[model samples]
Target chain A: MRKPKLSDEDYPTTGHEWDGIREYDKPMPRWWLWTFYATILFALVYVVFYPAIPLVNGATPGVLGWSTRADLAAEVEAVSLRNADIDQRLLDTPIGDLGADPDLTRYATAGGAAVFRTYCSQCHGAGAQGAKGYPNLQDDDWLWGGDLEAIVLTLKHGIRDDGDDDTRFSQMPAFGDILETGEIDALTQYVLSLSGQDHDADLAAAGPVLFEENCASCHGETGLGEREQGAPNLTDAIWLFGGDAETIGHTITFSRYGMMPAWNTRISEAQIKQVAFYVHQLGGGE
Target chain B: MTDQITEPPRLFEAREPVFPQRISGWYRRLKWRIMLGTLAIYYLTPWIRWDRGANLPDQAVLIDLAHARFYFFWIEIWPHEFYVVAGLLIMAGLGLFLFTAALGRVWCGYACPQTVWTDLFILVERWVEGDRNARIRLLRSPWTLRTARLRATKWTLWLLIALATGGAWVFYFADAPTLLADLVTFRAPFVAYATIGVLTATTFVFGGFLREQVCTYMCPWPRIQAAMMDEDSLTVAYRDWRGEPRGKKHENTSGDCIDCMACVNVCPQGIDIRDGQQVECITCALCIDACDTMMEKIGKPRGLIDYVALSDEPLERAGHPPRSIWSHVLRLRNFIYFGLWTGIGAMLVVALFIRSDFSLAVTPDRNPQFVKLSDGTIRNAYTLKINNQTGFARDFHISIKTDEPLRVDLEGTAELNVTVPPDGVLNTRVYIFAKPEFEANRAETTPVRFWVEERAEAGARTHADTVFTGDTQ
Candidate 1:
């Protein structure tokens, strides 16, 4: 091998000097130059093959014709295709029979939870904890019933809604207009006594006769509150509006009416079943 | 010493291109074996299948970024449990420190991917274009059709090796067989192709072309490794006490070196060992093999260039026996590093065994902290996330422990028992209603805890504490 001259005087200078040093004007390594060229070639080919350069009107559609939107659509399509079978099973299976298959149960419950968050969580809280007028779905106190079938029916027809003819409808007469104030006060004492709460014994004694005469048909003789009539049980500590003496007196005098919108016309059948199944699984569902 | 240090680069000086001659010895064989073992592990680990039950992936070692899970042979890591991975990285750092203190740059020489792949590329180059002399001749000669053909063949082989190197890396993130098929059919995801493309270009340029420059300049390990090595650390060194004052032949008249330049020709880094220790030396010990062969040819003692500790140089020059390599390797510094490395390893193992597969995390709703129900009851909402890390689906019963009379109510169903899918997270919206008395005597915020228990598995329980915001009294 020939030894390269290391002396500054022997080197071919580029006429650039600083601090008593001269530049040699040595060529870059051949392999390094070729690698640089190879990178440029690769970039040119990549530009031609992939969507890269932007034009005045729009981006250039390269040979590969890849678009981010199309890629996302394809990914979404693939996921749906994989889930198609489970979705179909959810639709075919009865909401009552959903608990029989664990896998299907899981799928429906997950889907139902999502559906509830979208639709049912407005009036009812996101956790299905009902507001003042709305029925708290988490409690054992169901205005209609708490069973899976009962929830399904309620979800379909709603309660006292004007749109649905089959909606559960009930109304208490405005006792303030019908009876004297003394009579409404006595009835509140009678209602409080049934729940085993503190009340005036003599007032309750006089209140039962009026309660037996006015509320026996739908509330039952024992005040268990018939599910068919959607009347809340007065014997339990739970109350739809309020269980206090004043509120009970006001409820009896002016009457209380709660309305729920039917979801059959609003949401799909699958979604209705899912939400019903979801609500039934809540701890309050019997 | 003055000859050892080069002055700052002159404006007119040209870089000396390194063209290392091939050599073989015990160290070379050891290097070849390590390269084969490391490369095999890298290329084949993702293909090894482990039956992870029905719903989970079967790859033995995988990083499932989509699911935020990492699976390694029997061990699985969740996103929240990334501390184990961090602990492992710390152990690796300590291990590097320990190994570097005992044996200088052994990791760089034997185990580093840059060293291993560069060696492989050089081997292929030698097989096609012949060894050092022939390659130098080819570089010096004028361009010819034969030389162009050889160059094309060498570059194509290098490209294929680089492609395979990159191809094996992507398999760790996905199912090996399925991704391989997808890649072959041009149906793989864009990220997969993009990753392979970037890695391919890097491997080709770094392994096939840059070679030793990666160790000397690009990598930070070599600099860190220099700090780890001490006077007692074993490194490839010339026995200059005997080999110096070189180039004479008569008995007792000259040193053993003979100024043959064999050591320089055989060095991958192309630095002269006679110039003393420099940061560029990787301690590959190939120069030792080369010098030993020359010594054997001249009927002189081998080991003119051999593994030696710097502290032993004075003793050996005074004609006293130097310390053994075992004595040099087993010192206080190495012992301390080993102790720290193993201490973390032991702690990690203990934590792994004690940790529960099921975990509960509660996030209380903040927007409307407390909602007053129709019956004059205050309700607080929380989003509960239950993580089931078991291989099979499990039923977890949710309950709460609080001093206040709080009723736990999950949104979906009346059932307290929730079936969490295998290796999945179940998010349930929960509403806790305070009793009438509790609501009447409310605090600004009440501390509450939500607990989860695996129904079938005893002792598998975890809980999360969250604040239940309520009306101030």
Candidate 2:
């Protein structure tokens, strides 16, 4: 051994001085050096056991062959298996009696809320509050029906869906080709007055007779609407298209055809049932 | 000092083994009692059980990290109520400070696990290898079969103690009986085994081998105590004035100290008490016991090595009476620390007792804010989490108290009645509908209170205030 120890003045330094300040170049502790070497060894071993190096196309597959994607898939599969019993229960439960089982009701509603946000929210609004032309699902008024079974049917076949043979289909002839401009104007005023909107009383005088002859078959004589025929109620403040006279005139001249795609073709049966259950419980189901 | 000495100091100083001579005195007996008392408390605490009904664990003291709860006898702390645990930690710290300022390192000398466990390890060592002189001689002697057998016996005993210490710690985190059964069957969690392994290694190395070095180098409490101490703080110190001017035994010249090394030999720290107060001294007062015994044998007075404040040194040297211990202990700083320590404990107790058995959190739906109904009624949806912390399943009736003619209803149930399980949280939705053209229906948002009342208790009720959104926005 050269020497046991050296005093501070004779200790080795980094050799770069600044303003009479010199840093000591002390040897690292044996334990600390060994820990550093162990860390490097661990990295090397980890690279061989896990995907570590990045390639142009993808990461290099290690011998163990584990991936985060596969891990996530396994977790999802595990959860699916865990809830298989509950999912079966939800499927077997009658749509109308769902409310009787609080557990299934909660499961359906919570699941339906997720399905709604993912698919139905774009058209019907996130809370099923509806946009301009779409029907407000949270209201008691329903063009088709608002009950659980009715909602399920609407979800399965949809309103005016062309692909589904059992789709709720209805059509009103565009009055612009059949009626005079003066008659259509009178009908517009009368339609607005039915909803208690401001209108010219004199122009609306011919509306009741004209509506009874032309619109009373699907729309009731009192204009309360026929749910079996899939017609809307006119007395309510909830308007699907618009309640203004201009929109009403346009509706009379060129009739409205709202299209809702059959959800059964798009989403799973459980998802369809859940979304229906979700809409029914939004304080609107009769 | 290094320049004057011909021999140079090594960069890495090799450790010299400490073999404290076995001695008995008032301090030694007190340490033994404290060690036994503390060890019994540690090893036996997990076996205590208290009933917490069907829904909760019955362990009297458990951290229950899986459930994010702390159960201690009658009180259970929820994750949100972690401030109570923080308050307890603060009280413990302040208590340490108060004791250090008054009596000096009482925690370190008598109560610290390191001190207690190391004392036990040393006792085992003494039994296996004889007393201090014999152990020193064995160290210098060449290895032999008998020596190997003694070493093996001592090490095996130390390992058993270390294993027990580690096993005791794991019991605090889980149910003791169930975990113990699982551990014996080798079905315990990997983390539990890993924790035991790590703790066992640390306890063995720290308590068995590096005993005084831990206090002198690793522990920060003794260094922090330097700031807490003053002239009036009672520390284990030597009255060098009376005992210095050293003379050989029976050839005593002028001082009481006969140059006997009884105080040093019996010291756990292996530090001479006559060298005055040092950081290495745990102030265990073992040296006082050893020196006092020697004094009686030689027909001299005891307390040559005694507990005294630095300020009392001058007064005692002049032959005047030393001040009372109360004068040294009851200072303004110590009283303030004690007041703070007790105040937090009192506040935590009050908080625990006054905590509600049921709680509510109402979150209004942010998706659509408000939905206008067919009859022009404005509706707002809310999700309420009702936490029933009690042991019984509870029925809570939901009602809205508002000036907006708002009607509250629970979805899927017309009666607005909800049953929450014991010690469970119920996540359910609520629908509030306002009358057509109500005053608040014209406004953007209206304030509303959701009252959830337990049906069992006539007056037990809680309310969560939230806003009912309207059509204006």
Candidate 3:
């Protein structure tokens, strides 16, 4: 090591001084200066290899041609490749027997939740509870059925979806086209009476006869509904749409035909199964 | 002395090397024992075995990062219970404060890892290069084959010690024996090697090269000691009142101090203690031993350089007896710190004993508060998270308590009993349905609580409260 340097008083000072006090003209540490230079060199190298500088059109595509979007795509592609076997296994297994492997059920349920959020939440709900025209999935009332196989079939080919030839096709004729206004009004009261809702008994007296003649084939004699025909059980507290007197009157007059898109066209077969697993575990699965 | 202080650049300066001469004294022996005890504990703690079930780790002290758990013998801390760790850290800080207020800079001198490791490194240096005089001679001399050989031998030993220091640390985070085999076979995780590499480099540099400079310029504790120390605090100081009028031991009118430079020569800090309470003094008491030995040789009383408080200096100058060490230690500041330290410790112990082996959390679905089902019944969906934070796989019977007749159903099973692996967290959906008769008269919001009870221990139960929204219009 060098001998101790000249005293602080003897050392050269910057011209700036306060009273008799003077600041020493000490240079920065050599390592610090070297590190600063290294950072500058790194920045220059980074500009050449990475998309750093922004232009009006977009960022400059450096020689490496790396982009964050491309990077994310690669990462997603890598994960997809890794889970190919798991996805295949989930698709191969029957939906009813998924719970035989609890671990695989868990994986399917978790991945299904992510898929539901991305693809199904818009129409049904984030919680899988359907909105106004859509069905409340958490209830025991299913348009067709609530079992795993039934739900999976419904998911593949949605209700009254025109695009899918094998979709759950059902249509209630508009009573205004076939029946008189007074007859339609009487049928509404009887339909409301079936669920034990408030109704005019005198007007509803003709409901059983009218229901038998027009709606019994699909809605059943007791108005319990036919799942094979996608007719909702009128006696249930849960309703796909509103269950008020006005809504019931309108349903009789105009009929209801709700539409849900076939998910098979939009999501993968494995994703469909995963979402079925997730929805099946949402406390309402049969 | 003030003028001798240099104004080095804020963070960097040319370090002055210190070659502390070899000495033997009561304090040096005590320091040696303490150093050995601390180092032994640090290196061997991971290897100690505690039977915490076969499924869990057997290491007495382990930080299971993968599982996010901290295990210390019989005690286990989940990540959620990190406040206990925080409380321990606060206790450690308070302990340093109490000791510093009572006896200044004692931690820096005796127990600081920097001090202990540097002492060990210096001991190695002495064995290879002789004591202070010989090391200085080698430093001043031109390069020689013997010097090269000795330097290589010394550095090789230092590096080995540093590697061991780092190797011991990695074991704390994993199963020690398993990790050790994996490490030697180069099959260990990348993080373990990275941690060992970083720690090895830091230990080698900080202990071998920096030495006393760490205490003097690098450590923030030395500066913070100003607030901790007071006039009553005992510090290593030269008794200038007795030692003044300094002259040669042969002189007729000389003070007790011989001006022999033994105190200065033996100082690990390379500072003269006679310079009236310098900050560099770690109060290690090596100088007191050196000066006392010289004093006895010169037919004078010991303690020419001694541990004395400034307040006692004036009384001692008037030829009064010094007060007891307890008188300084049992003051108000120390009492407050000690009280706080024990209070937190007591609270932690109470909390640890009172804590249950499991935890429960319930979150109801917000999107649809209630669902009206087919049977004129109202239903609510909830997600329950049950944490089985124990060493053994356990069964938990999950049930609900409410004023209304609410039927609870777990998704996967007919019954509510679930088996959770040791230290596992189970998340499942639960459906709560109101009785059909009570559906019409249900309240807007009914308060309900879900309880998770250990099957083996009936009293071991935890509960979380939530609301059940009305599905009836």
Candidate 4:
């Protein structure tokens, strides 16, 4: 090959020139040219292997015959298969039994977290930190017992419920009708004294006799509450309703019965047990 | 030094291509305003907050894929109502067509992703390598270290822009705050990273490299827009009657013509409007601003290049009275498009109004079709799936309605009370047994209705109907 000479006559140029500044008729870059050809080849391959070309009725199904719908179905099937063992285990094991296995417990907790966020998070916060009316699951203070069995029972049969028979039943009598205002005050002071709160010694001494008459049937002699009766312990520092003097007086004057909903018909029995364990492991569960 | 005088460097340098040094006019200012406004909106929308009660996402525009819900300020879309997304896509298409018919290719010029990205890329190019003339000189110059450095800087800026574009896109799919945290910690979901990678590559390829080619050759909108346009539609045009018999400045004795090529240089699509309208022209009107500036400088009146309707051009040429064709934009074609668009919108609204919170589906147990009881009662097994789309948990009271005195039996519980968790579905197997007398009275195929009533809310009810088949009566 001979070297080309650099001469004005040898160069191809645009016919028009401004003050001898000529435009060279150079071809496009080789890389750009190759890229163009490669892209056309890629498009041909893509059309042959994918649903690219539109036909009269529907798009052309490629040699692979793959579709977005099929891909989605396959993905769903894969996920389902991955979770099948855990799902089957969840179906087979009793909710109470779920907490015993750490793996199942982890799975249950994750599942319960999603369920709680969707269902219970409205009343109870997303973190299960309850509002004024809602009971906080993170706290140790539970109106009912905090064991898995107790929580399951509570979920299965709601408290003060009219429908189911096994519901936790407690009816504090209207002490307002039975006792005078002064007597109610004495009783409230007496109840507060059970938890070592300050009270009039003479009034508390006299209130013992009043307690034996009306409240001793449900609450035991020492003022520790009964679980079966759904009566709260008076001796404990944690209060379900409230511990203030006026609140105690109001409770005596007009007995408050807090209603807990039955979640058994709504959530699975196992889920209730899982939540119970989750709550039981929280600071105050007994 | 006096003997070496060089004729004052030939008195004038060669006029290089420099975008014809066009002055910014109304259209150019409008384009700048739109660019600034759109960019501001896009970058700031993610941070706007809307309180959606407690425990719900606060972002005004959120696609909570984890929750399978989309929240747009006051509106919330559930997964089951994905048809809303389909409706939105249809509305967008129709809106584009409407805008195209009224003012051709306006979206491609002002709002399209290709146009926006290409404009951004061009801005970066201008910042680093200077404007059109400087770019051409830099390309023609021999490979120097300074030129290489400038090229490198431009590419870095372009890559950064492409990355930012990709990064902003993933924020729409998840909670922007959480995803940002996860991304920083390298704990983002695999899908998020994969999506960003794909988007980054596409943005770099299409925005930085492909640029106007995406609009001119790749996009299908220009092809579709050709059919949508009519003679009365407004388009950027060259008034050849006013500008032809073109010649250089001081030599323009014919038809007020000046062969400056200002319009050609300022055109983003690189098309000559004087050659008449072509598919590549996005109608950006940079050319209008350029030509207007040139006309003003040459002591000629403006609108040698202007927006005009094809229908009025012939009439004006024939010396007939110019008819106002703005009213023609609302012709039969537009009316039909509007009708269909409104009809779809109205149907979606009505469907939204009638949407139910509770749904019931029945699946007949195929394994054992019918179980013959000891008391000669015919029994059929079925799995009833109940979906509660409400936000709160509901206590469902299930009852069977049949032609005969059919008794419903649950596997474990005596009461047919089901509690469906909020926004959840429950599948429970149910057994229906007919009394012997009722079985004797029943036909081979009997229709049975399963009704679910929410105890907490009395109004919420759903029903599923299925046929109970028996072996030889």
Candidate 5:
């Protein structure tokens, strides 16, 4: 054994030097060295017990023969087993009665959110806050209706969709050639005036008579827009195209029609119910 | 004269091994009992079966993370009731405070897992390689086949104990019998194996190797316990007033101390009781038992090293009798801590008993606000969520309370009786159609309460208050 009284100068040093400083080759701490070796042993054991080595076909099966896919399947199975009761109850309970039970409502809401994310989020933003032309599900403005049953019907048949016979179909006559340009301008001012927006008073006064004669049958005498006809409320701030005077004049002349695909063939009935339940709760659905 | 310069000692020194000498007395026996009791509870709790009807798990104490439920015998806690777990943790904290204020570090000395497991490892070491002197000699001796064999046997035993400790912990998270079978067959989850491996490594390193270093360096409790304690708190201390002026006993002229170092040898923390209280001292009182035995053998009074309050130390030095242990134990601070601890426990118990098994939550649809049906009646859509928390199936009658006549339609069905499965919820969309006359008289929003009553139980009912949205204008 080396003498304990040896000076630091006598200690072995690495050949490398920086400035005047020389590096001493001291041994690693005993506990740290042991811990490192222990981890290596643990890794070896782990490799033997779990899939580690890669092959042409796949990774090694390992001693335990476990796979991530199998684990995921088991987890998915466990969750489904847990939710089986709620799922059955949801299927049996009337869509209208779903809100009466808190647990079922929560389940439905969550299911609805998942469905919305998969199908509706592309058009209706992730939060169901709509983009232009796509109706915002979270606002108290609906072309058809905001009631649960009305929303469900809209989801099933959709508006002006091609494939479905029961699809909500409405056509506003394009008065571009039928009516004079001056009459269309007067109607725009009258439509703007209904919402109390700033407009030409003389034109609006002349516009109401034309509106009462032409628009009242569909848009309602009060300009509140008939839900049965899918006419948007002229008074509300929400507008699918644009609420400006020029946009209104163009819409009156050429006529505005928005098409939404029927979701009956795209998503399951349960999913439609779930999405309706979810959209209904987005601080919007009546 | 010139003084020779010498290098200063390194501030950080490698850990020195401790060889605590075996000493038997009340404290040691008490420590043994506590260690065995705690170990038994920890190992056997998961194995105890509970009968919670048909669908639930039968573990007496289980934290069912998979199901997001905590089952403790008869009490089944859902994820929403996690406040009960928080209350329990708070009670544990307050309990430690109460005990610490009354008796300093009684938990650390008698009940800490580190101390208990370290004591077990030490006992095993003593059995394999004799007591203190022999173990020290064996360590210092050059490696021989006999010494190597003894060391190997000791390590093997320590590893087994650690393995058992680790294996027992994972059983609490799963079904004990099934998991044990799966583990034996090497078919358990990889995480379970990993958990056991990690726990085994930690238990072995902490209990067998790091022992006292954990209490001194790793743990923060000793530092916090210092703040919890006061002068009146009872702690294992050396009665310096009686044993000071240390020397050989000569008649009544000198102090009774014989200058024996038995107290230091038997100390688990390797602290000298004569140096007053210290952070290193766990207050385990093994030194007291050693000192008492030595004093009795030498025909002197015991209690040379004993539990003494700092407040009593001055009194004893002034030739006055120390206050009784009860006088220190029943202080106002300790009383308050005890009261707070029990008060929370009582509140939790009350909440557990009074909470309803079912609940009704209604969310009225707001989009488009209210729809005007073709018949001119105003209809409001509501999503009702009925939570049935009971274990058995139940039939519920749904009803609504409105100021005026309202037609409630659930999927066009007029019947309000609903049957829900066990431990489930029934979700439904309700369209409440208010008569035009009713909407004309009521405001834009009317107060409506939705109620669900168990068909068999007279008073088992829950109700949610929601607005009856309408187009009043």
Candidate 6:
């Protein structure tokens, strides 16, 4: 850019001189002056075309007829259209059948992950890492059986729950009244020994007879509880109540009966099956 | 060095008219970029869309005040979670303080709305009426048809920008596209138009007309900033030690300064930096830019006008220059501020973690403590208000437990299965009646527990407790 010459007509001279310093009052460029005018014209056009002046009653709607709500609605409609195919497919196919289709399975898994975060994360931690007293689905152990069919049944019919008829009906008898305190203690030791924990040799020996007479019906000969009856396996390291001697003694004396809530009345069977398959896929199902 | 110092140089200078001559430099470019960036974001953010399923607005950023909902991308904020907004404001304040302590007035100079809009308006003026010199000359010129047209055109552009600025602001409050349409069709709500008008007037007045006067006089930031600044704070400064004993170039050999008044001429705020730091100075470095260009032309050092804190100060006892001011920014005051800021942030996060999903309140019917029913049963009335804070609608079953065999009788619905809309409050009047035998055995006042259980699919349940009061036996 060439510097314009400072002429007396175009430049206004500053009279103040400090150490021979002076300023020229030069006129601004005409192009710059026109741009300012252009901006004003644009503003007027904008006000006339869009919402601008506020009347006593309300704002004056411009001629362009644009609105934020309409824009948002249009955007939402576009997104909904994009997801329409997958959403329709989800509705058409049974949740169980979704497992067979890889694309559907992927979609369901992602959808399940989001649902799990919103609904299941409170009790079962965000990562499905169960806290104390809550069952960890990541492991192979299942109190109500791990098979897809069995899981679906168990979810639909909660254990010992009065609300649903399909509930898994299994209640450990209160041995507190049946067995003597010493006998209960001996059986507790035997149960602990089944998991390979240290136990009193004499007590374990006596517990074998007690186990055969009272517990073997459900626990089986080797103390590996029957899954059909919702009886827990005794050979595994994992314990529902506790593995400690005191806890084992208490379990035998009181007879622990943890309840799994019935979902038939709350959640549909399809949903239960979907959740069951999801839990089975957690990698621990037998 | 041998010259004896009589009195220390005065800390302040008498006010002098700046008359800054405009010049272009790196700092000026940086300011322009920032101003443009901020303006684009402000005007365009309302148009961005986010998918929020059905029955939800898709605007990326929106504040649905009518429904008490705030949408920011994927996160949805409810009125109950207003604490999040409060926490954010606190965080912003602390962040500003920290930034100010480190680089004095950087936010004011580069990022403040006032600075950005004013710069835009100034650009518009420069484009229309020419630069500072041209504008000054035009002001002195006699009134003519061309001059009037130019002036009118400039005002028109300023007004349009102001209107747009105001219009964009209301979009945040409602759905932008629909409101725009409503605005055009003349069907938009009155409040929307009123808000836009107010904003437009303010933008035009503050950004176009008042301009520098707002920053120099009206704004409270200058007063607060004075206290925030320390000697070590990095600020736009003229190196008096180098530029003093000023004289024009090719005339007298004294100091690096050419006595060109370029720095004063270019200043938007019209403040002279050579007169020492003033409260009116926004530290925009425009003056530094003006002086640097003058230095380049005069073959003097560029830093004759530069950003300097107290790093150049000499240690009185040690006889060496003390540590740079930057190191002091990380010292006790800043550390304490940081600690409090983090502490509050952590507390807010913890509070969010512990926040309950359901809120419930129980109020006993004051009219009749206990009514003797026709069937020989005593009845107590209660109003249970339940707040469902979840995203989906929920059905909550209400049950009452007391010493007596009391049965809950909901006034309207037989089943106490109340359906509470998402983020909504549901109020139900419940009547508890006791069998004659049970009521006869009870004391004058009976303690009862009101329980609300949300039975969700997958067996997920949430329970809240309140109390149902009954008259004494």
Among incorrect, acceptable, medium and high, the docking class of model 1 is: incorrect
Chain B TM-score by candidate, in order shown: 0.94, 0.95, 0.94, 0.87, 0.92, 0.84
- Alpha carbon lDDT of residue A64, candidate 3? 99
Which residue pairs overlap in candidate 3's backbone?
A: none
Chain A agreement with the truth for model 1, given as TM-score: 0.74
Output the number of the TM-score-best candidate.
3
lDDT of 4 at B420: 82
lDDT winner between candidates 1 and 3: 3
What DockQ, between 0 and 1, does each candidate earn? 0.06, 0.28, 0.38, 0.01, 0.07, 0.01
lDDT of 5 by residue, B1-473 (tens): 22332554342445666789999998899998999999999889999999876767888998888877788988878777799999999999999999999899999998999999999999999999999999989988899998999999999999999999999999989999999999999999998899999999999989989888789877999999999999989998988878877876664446777777789888778667887888878888899899999998988888999999999987899999889999999989999999999999999999999988888889887644565543346667788888777677889888899877788877457888888777667887787877667853346688898998989957598899998876654
TM-score computed on alpha carbons, candidate 4? 0.61
How would you encode candidate 2's per-residue C-alpha lDDT over A13-95 as one tens digit per residue? 77878999787665543444555799999999999999999999998899999999999999999998987888888889888
Pairs that clash in candidate 2: none
> lDDT per residue, candidate 2, B287-373, as tens digits?
889988988998888888888988888899899989999998888998899889989989998999899988999999886787777
**TM-score for each of the candidates:** 0.71, 0.83, 0.89, 0.61, 0.73, 0.56
Q: For residues A1-286, write the lDDT of model 4, one tens digit per residue.
A: 1122224344555566889867654344344566679999999999999999888999989999999999999999998799779877876887667757868877776766666777667766775656554665654456677666676687678888877777877889889999988788888889979887788877777798899998988988888888778777787655656677888888888888777667778877556655655544432345
- Provide the lDDT at A48 for model 4: 94
Q: Give the proportion of true interface contacts each model preserves, from 0 to 1.
A: 0.02, 0.41, 0.49, 0.00, 0.00, 0.00
The prediction achieving the highest DockQ against the true structure is: 3
DockQ of 2: 0.28
Encode model 1's per-residue lDDT on B424-455: one tens digit a residue: 88988888888668842277878888888878
Ranking by TM-score: 3, 2, 5, 1, 4, 6
Return whichever of 2 and 5 wins on DockQ. 2
lDDT of each: 0.84, 0.86, 0.86, 0.75, 0.84, 0.74
Task: Pick the winner on TM-score between candidates 1 and 6.
Answer: 1
Could you arrange the candidates by DockQ from highest to lowest? 3, 2, 5, 1, 4, 6
Q: Is the docking of candidate 4 incorrect, acceptable, medium or high quality?
A: incorrect
